[model samples]
Target chain A: MNGISAEQLNQAHQADLAIQSEEGVVFEHAWADPDEGVIYCLSDAPSAEAVMRIHQRAGHPADEIHAVPLEV
Target chain B: MNGISAEQLNQAHQADLAIQSEEGVVFEHAWADPDEGVIYCLSDAPSAEAVMRIHQRAGHPADEIHAVPLEV
Candidate 1:
């Protein structure tokens, strides 16, 4: 969480949306754990690399990427 | 990701759902990175502790818990 404020997350999310279309990524949801300095975002993308690219361009590169092929 | 399979995640998710009602937790989604040995789950719960409790009862205690109060 590293003292990240709601405003910062909102701004980052907005930035992500702005550039996502270029990568065929649709950000669905985001959750922040400010206490843990962690953020979790749900998105639809062509691949895990696409998600990471968007995040990197948005100015916050993800620490890890996981492919979610199945949902229940 | 640790070689965890989709079936394993499905089983854990089902177990969480079975006992979540007692703790006021609703697991919404889950994503697994078997290669990374990590599982990320999204849930609606009274608190981070409540979510952890449900996961624990289901036999998969989360390594970390984050409160997601904002979404985009």
Candidate 2:
């Protein structure tokens, strides 16, 4: 996937306002493995720390959360 | 993601030789949703019909399996 631009991230953050109100925080893309049962996702939060907080609050704590761009 | 080329699919089928020996057939990319508990994947099977057959045998049959390329 192309790297998300700062402007895009900002827009995503703005768009997530509604989701944040309901789901707490919305991840861009999230998926889990059937066999391994591991979930992975990309979130546009204020910071990597915020991403972890979101996951923690969701009760599905991430096994690994990286502050990196997702490559397709 | 780029569309799987006929040659790439052929190579993948050949490379999956080892997996087919054990797991029956291998999918290219697969993911599931934790909350939704739905799985999605890309498979380069002999035919669309074959793709469904693989999923049926896997037990967690697909809810929607399209014969379209996955866009990253």
Candidate achieving the largest TM-score: 1
Q: Tell me the tens digit of each residue's lDDT in model 2 across B1-72.
A: 134344543443444343442433557654333333334465655655666665555443556555432211
**Fnat measured on candidate 2:** 0.00
> Which ranges in model 1 have alpha carbons more than 4 Å from their true place?
none
The alpha-carbon lDDT assigned to residue B23 of candidate 1 equals 94
CA-based DockQ, model 1 = 0.60
By lDDT, the best candidate is 1
Tens digit of per-residue lDDT, candidate 1, span B8-66: 88998999999999999999988887776878888999998999999888888999888
In angstroms, the error of model 1 at B56 is 1.8
On the 0 to 100 scale, the lDDT of residue B66 in model 2 is 51
Error of 1 at A21 (Å): 2.0
Interface RMSD for each of the candidates? 1.8, 13.1
Which lDDT value does model 2 have at B11?
46
Best by DockQ: 1
